[model samples]
Target: MKKPVIFLSLLASLIASQSCTNLEEQVLDESFSPSISYADIANGTLAPVYALLPSVFLHTNYFAIQEISTDEAILPYRGGTDWGDNGIYLALHQHTQTSTDPNLKNTWNFILQGISRSVSAINEFQGKTDATSQLYLAESRGMRAYYSMLTLDLFGVVFVKNSVGETSKVIRGAEAVEYIKSELLAVEPNLSTTVGPGRLNKAAAWGLLARLYLNAAVYRNVTAQTVTFSNDDLDKVIEYTDKIINSNQYQLSPDYFSIFNSDNHSNKEIVFAVDQRAELNGHNRLAYFSLSGDQFPLPAFPAANGTDGPAITSDFYRTWVNAYGSQDPSVDPRFYKQNLSIYSNPADSCVTAESFNINRGILRGQQYGLIRKNGVFLKCPDGKMKVGKLYNDTRNRPTTPVIFTEKVDFTVAGSDYSTGYRVEKYEFSKKSSSGRNLGDADIVILRLADVYLMRAEAKLRKSNDAASALADVNTVRASRKAATPPPALTSISLDLLYRERGFEFYWEMLRRTDMIRFGKYEDTWTEKTNTDRNKRIFPIPQTAIDGASNLPGYLVQNPSY
Candidate 1:
C-alpha cells in the first residue's frame, strides 16, 4: 500500500487497539455515510488530531529528533542510541538531498495527515453556523495552521489540501507561510478567546503566527539577508503575548516542577499542551523513556537499571550552571534541580557526605570525573550524557561497578548515581498507581518566558544596543532563581541569545530551530560536529517519494533524493 495509506491504517490500528473505545464508535460512526452532513464530519475529525498532538512525543521518534536536530537539546553520553540518528537527520536537513529514509517518510506522512484532517474540517464547514460547528471549525483551522507550521519548519514545502485526497497541490516556503497566516487570521475572528488551557484559542492561533513571523528569516532564507520583521508581525506577537500573559487565564507557576506534575495540567503556566490521557494511547513517552532502568528509583519495576538514564549534555548543562557563578551554588536551587548529583564518591567512602563533591561531582564508568565545580557534566566523546553507573544482573546492587552501556536518570529519586546530570525539568515527583503513567504535568509549548526571549531576539536584531533586550532575556533567568539577571548589554548577538535560549528553553524542542535560525546549523560540536548542512531538513522519506510518483513532479522528492 502507499505510505500515506499504510500510515493511516497504522493510525487506525493503534487507535482501535489502544483507545478506550473504538474511535469510530466514540468519535465517529463507521456506519456513517460519506454523505454525512459536513457539520458532523467536522466534529468527528477533531478526535484524531487532538489525539495525535500529545502522542508526538510518545517515542524517541519525533520528539527528540525535532529538538536535537535543531539545537534546543541533545542526547549526549550515548544515553539514547536513536538520538544520534536524529542528529544525522538534522545535519542532513541543512541542505537539499535526494536521500530517502523511512523514518523521514513516517514523520512527513503523520504531519501532513494532521494538516489534511484540519483542512478537511475547514472544507466541510464552509457555511456551518451552529455554535458547536463554528467552534469546531475555528479549532480545526487553528490546528491546521499549527501543523502547517511544522511542515514549513521541517520540509520547507507542504501539500495544502482542502479535502482528504491525493490531488492536493504542493505549497512552497513563502507560499505556505502566506497560506498559514491567512488561515489563522481568518479563524482568529471566529475563535473563542476564552478557551481553557489545553485547547487552541485565539491567542494560540496568534502565538503560532508570532512563531512563523519570528522565524520568517530562516523560513524564507532571509536570516542573513538583512530581513526586517514587519511592524505588523511584531505588533501581533506582542498583542498575542500580552493577551495570554495578562488574561489571568494562565500564570507562571512559582515552582517549575509544578508545571509538569500529573496534577498540574490546569496550571496557568501552560499556553498549549498536548492533552495526554494515560494508559489509553496518550503521550506517555516522557515518563516512559525518561525513567532509568526502573531499578534504583523503584525497586519493583521490570526495567530498573539505575544506570540507563538520560543525562543532560555537558555543553547544555554548562549553560545552566554558568548562569549562577558569582554566588554560592548552594543558594541557586535551579542547578540542584536541573542537574541532580546522586552518586556517592567511592573514595570518599562517606555515605553521610554531601550529595555531591565540591570538586568532582559525578563519576562515569569510563573512570573520568566531570568537574562539578564548574557546574557542567563532562561529556563522553559522543554527545550523549555520560553514563555514571550500570547494572550487571538487575540484582539491585548499589556498589557494583556497572559498565556505561545505557542512559541513566540520576535525578530520579531512587537512582543514586550519575554520569553527568539528569533533566529534572519534566521529572515526576509523585507516584501513580496506574502503571506509573499519571504525569498530568502540562508541558508548556509556548509560555510567557519564551515570548520574552523571542522579543529580546527581535529587539537585539532591531536595536544594536540591547540592554533592554538583555533585561527581558534575563527575566527568564531570574525566574530560575539567578541572583540577578545576566548583565545588561549595550549590544547583543544571536550567539548570546542562542545560549540564553538553551538555558531558557532547553529540552522544549526549540533547540534545533534556534540553531538553524541563528545560522549555526553548520557549527561543529564534540559528536555533532560533522553533520551535513542539508540534513538540517529531514529527507522526504523514500516511501513518500514513491507514493507521490503518480502526481508527476508535483510531489517531487527533496533535492538529493
Candidate 2:
C-alpha cells in the first residue's frame, strides 16, 4: 500500500493550527508525489474524512434542525434565560430560521467539510488499479454519496464536485436524487461487507440506497401537498432493504435501550452509525443536553451536569399518549428504561461507592438523581453517595422542584425550566465524567429495526400488501422484549406506520424527515404554526452564497428561506 504521508502531515498541522476551514484548498493545491502509490495509503488515511461526522451530527448542530425544527423536539429559553442564543432555537422550532442562524451555518460548514475531505480522498485514490486501492476508493465514493444525501436532505441542494478545486454543480430536485443514487450504485459492488458499521460497507450502502429510494418522492418534490410515490421506487426500496435483511448480518436487539448504550459499538442492530468510541472526539450533549441542570448522572464527577437543553414537545408526546390510551408509555421498552433502581422510591436514599446510571427515555413528572452540595456530591450518613429529589437550583427557579411538565409554552412567561418532557435516550459516557465532551456511545444512523420499517412502508406503498406490511411492523414491535411488550397490531395503515416510526425512533434525529415524508410537516404543532411550504428546506447559508457570488448563480438559497 502507498502512503500519502504528505497529505497526512498537512492535515494534522492544519487541524492543530485551527486552519481546517481551508483544508480543501490546501489539500488540492499541494501536489502528492506519484511515487507514493495509493497501495501504501492504508485504511487509516480515510480517518480525516470519517472524523468530520461527530461534529456534524452533534446534538446542537444538525440534530437540532432534524429534530427541534419539527414537533418532535423543542429547546425553549429555559427559565427565560438559558439557551436563548438570540432566539435561534426558538426560531427553529417556530420555522422562522434565516441564513445567518449559527446552528445552520455551523452544520453547513461541518457537512461541507466532510464532502470536501471525501472528494480529496477520492481524488487521491483515483486511477488506482490495485484491489486494495479500488476497495478504498469505493468506500470514499460511498462516503461522498452519504454526505451528499444529507446535504440534499437538509439544504435542498447537492454540490457535485469531482475534485477539490473544480467548480461544483449545484443540483437539486430529481437531478440531485439521481446523482446520489448513481454514486451509491457505482460504489456498492466494491464496498467491503466485512467492515464495521462505523465504516461505510456494503450493508450500509444498501441501507442508504433503501432510504434514498423510500424518500425519493420527497426529494424530488419537497413542497408537494400530495407527493406521488412511484411503485418502481418503492419496489427498489423493498429490494435494497430485503437484501440487507437477508444478509443476516444484523438483528433487532431484545433490549431496545441497549442499542443506544455507551458500549453499543458492537451491537448487531446498528447497520450504520457515527462511531463515537472513546478514542474519537465525541460529544455527550445528546445524553446530557435534555437533562435538568441540577440532576447529575455521574456521581463520580458532580461538575458533569446537564445544560437543560431541548425536550420532547407536547405535540409529539400526544402521539404516544394517543396510541397507548390509558396505558402509560413507560410500559413499552422503547419509550423508557428505568436504570436507577435505587431511586425507584424517591424518598429512599441509597449509599453507593461508585457512579450510578440514570434513567433513560422520555422523562416526565418529578425527577430524582444524585444531589450535589458545595461543588461536591452529597454523601450519605455512612460516607457514601446519596440520591434524592432534584430541584431547579442552577437556574432562576431555584426553589422549584424538577418536575417536567407535559406542556411547554413558546413564550418566555410560560416556558419555565421544567415545562416540556425531557428525553434521555443515549447513556452518558462514564469516560466523560467531568464534562460534556468524551462520549463513547456510537450515534445510530441506520439500524435493522429501521430497515424492517422501511421495507414495511415500501410494501404498504408499492402494492398495498397490508398482510406483509403488518407482519413486518409486528416483527419490529415484538422485537422489543420488555416485560410486557407492545402487542402486535392486527392491522397497519400508512398513518399507523408513521406513528410506529415515531414510537420506535423518537429523539434519534429522524423526526423532521419522517414528518415531512408523511405529509405532517406543515401541520401546526406546539408553538410552530408556520405552514409555509418554502420552509421545507432551510436556507443555504448566506456566507456560502456570498463565497460563490463571483461565479454568478453558483449557489442559490433554498426557496422562501
Candidate 3:
C-alpha cells in the first residue's frame, strides 16, 4: 500500500536534517504536525522502515560485499571496461578493501537508513494506546533490532538509540549481543504470529534469534584466531529453531526452485523475506545480475537482458565436482534444471513457440537463445521460431561464441565476457517483460531449510550428536526430489554441513559470513591470497568516521583499516 504523502514528506525532512554519520538523527516531532492523524501514523509510519530493505539488498549494495568477497562468487571487469568502477569489486574479492570503498559506503548508508527509519517509526508509535498503534510499536522495535543485527554483522558495531535526538551509543562484542537479544525478547510477546513473511512476526523473531546465537562466537570475537561457540548459545539456537520447525508454519518445498519463483510470496518455505511486489517499486536485479548480457529470458521484450555481471568462482564449482565424483552435478535437482526443451536437439532449431525459459542453476558451456537478423528475430521458412548458439555480440565480441570457461583470471584477457560459470537461481519476473525493473519475487531473508540446518549444526557442535545432525541434513536433501533425486548423506561433519549450505543457499548472499564461520574465509581461493583475520569485518566507512570525527570515540574504525 502507498504511504501518505505527508508522512513521506516528514520522513524526507527528517533524513535531510541529519548527516550520514548520525543514524540516530533528530526525527521531526510528529506531535506538533497536525496533518498526520493516528490513523495515518498507524498506516504509514512503518512503511519507510520496510521500504529501505530492497535498496539495502540490491545487487550493487550489500549483495556485492557479501557475495563478491567470498570464494562462492567473483566479478571481474568484463572486457577490461565494464564493471571497472575504480577496482572496487576487485578489491572486495581480494580482501584489499579500505574505508573509502564506494560499495561499503553505500551498504553502510542503506543499513543506517533502515535503522534511522525504524527509530522514527518507534518514536511515532510510542504512548499510543490503540491496538494497531501498540502492535506497530512492537514491530518497529523488532525491526530496529533486526537492522542492528545486520549492522553488527557487517561493521562489528551496533548503534543503540531509543528515540529521536537521543545519542546512539555504539556497542560491540557481548554488550551488543545482549542489547539486540533483549530487544527481540521484549517485543516477541506482542508480535503477531500470523502476519506474512514480509513483516516481522513471532517466528521471524525466533529465526533471527537462532541466527544470532549460531554466529554469536564470530560477533563476540571479530579478530580472534579461534573463537569458541558456547554450549548455551548452541542450545539457544536449537531451542529457537525447534520452535519454528514445530510451529508448522513453514516447510521444505519439494520443488527446490519453487521457493525462489516469482510467486514465492505465498510459499510456505519462506519464513521471512523482503516483499518485492511490483507495485512497491520492486526490481529484477537479482535475476538479471549474474546472467550474461547476451542471454535474454523474455521473448516479448528483447531489450530485457543481463548486464554480464558476477559469476561462480572455480574454487566454488570444484566443491560440487568433488562431492559427487564420476557423476555430473546436474543429476541433483538443485544443481541444474533445463527449462528450454526445444534446444535439446542442437541441429534442429526451428520450433513454434512464443516464449521460453532459460536453464536454471549453475550455467556453463555454450549458451543459446533466439537469433536476430536485420534488427528482428529470425524465423524458419514455416514462420516458426528458431534458436541458435549465443555469441558475445552484446559485448562487441561476435566472433567469440558464448562458452563459459570453468576457470577465471583477474587479468583483462582472462576476465572476458564469457570467463566463468553464471547462476540463474531466481526466476526472471514475467511482469518485467518490458525491461529488468519490475519484479514480483520476494527476496528471501530467512527460510525453513536454514532453520533445520542451524539446529543440525547446533546439535553437532554442542553434543556431538552426529546421528541427529545427519537426520536433519538428509531431511532437507530428501525434500528436493527429481528424476534422479539427491541421495541421502550417510554421514555428516562440520565440513560437509558447510558444503551443503553452499549447495542450498548459493547466490542468496550468505557466503562471506558462512566462509568466516566455517574457518575458511582466509583460505586461498581463485585470485585471493590474503589470510588476514582482521579483514573478517569490513572497515567502518570513511564517510561515517569523518561525520563522527567531532565526537571522540563515537565511531572508531575497525582494527587495521
Highest lDDT among the candidates is held by which one? 3
TM-score of 1: 0.74
Could you tell me which 10 consecutive residues in candidate 1 have the lowest summed lDDT?
A: 352-361
What TM-score against the true fold does each predicted structure earn? Answer: 0.74, 0.92, 0.93
Ranking by lDDT: 3, 2, 1
lDDT of 2 by residue, 1-561 (tens): 633222222323334233223222212223346855433454545766787788778887878999999989888887777898999999998899999887787777777778877887898778978888788889888998999999889988887878765667788999999999999999999999988789999999999999999988999999888989999999999999999999999999989999998899999999999998887656646888898888888876778788888888888899899988999877788888877665566655775746467889999888888877677888877886787778877764557899988878677655777888899999888877355777899999999999999999999988899999999999988988745678889899999999999999998889889888999889998888999988888998776666565556657778886
Q: Which is the better candidate, 1 or 2, if ranked by TM-score?
A: 2
Go through the candidates in order and give each one's C-alpha lDDT.
0.54, 0.83, 0.84
lDDT of 3 by residue, 1-561 (tens): 632222212323444343232233224334637786766646677777887788778888778889999999899988888899898889999999999997787677777878877888898888888889888989999999998998899999998888766667789998999999999999988899999789999999999999999999999887778879999999999999999999998988989888888889999999999988776667647988988888877666677778888999999999999999999888788988887665576776776655566788999999887765444666789887777888877776778888888877688766888889999999888876455876888999999999999999999999999999999999999998644569999999999999999999999988899888889999999899999998999999887777666567668999889
Please estimate how well model 3 matches the true structure, expressed as its whole-model Cα lDDT: 0.84
Whichever of 2 and 3 has more lDDT, that candidate is 3
Winner on lDDT between 1 and 2 is 2
Clashes of each: 51, 6, 0
Q: Name the runs in model 3 displaced over 4 angstroms.
A: 1-40, 347-355, 373-375, 381-385
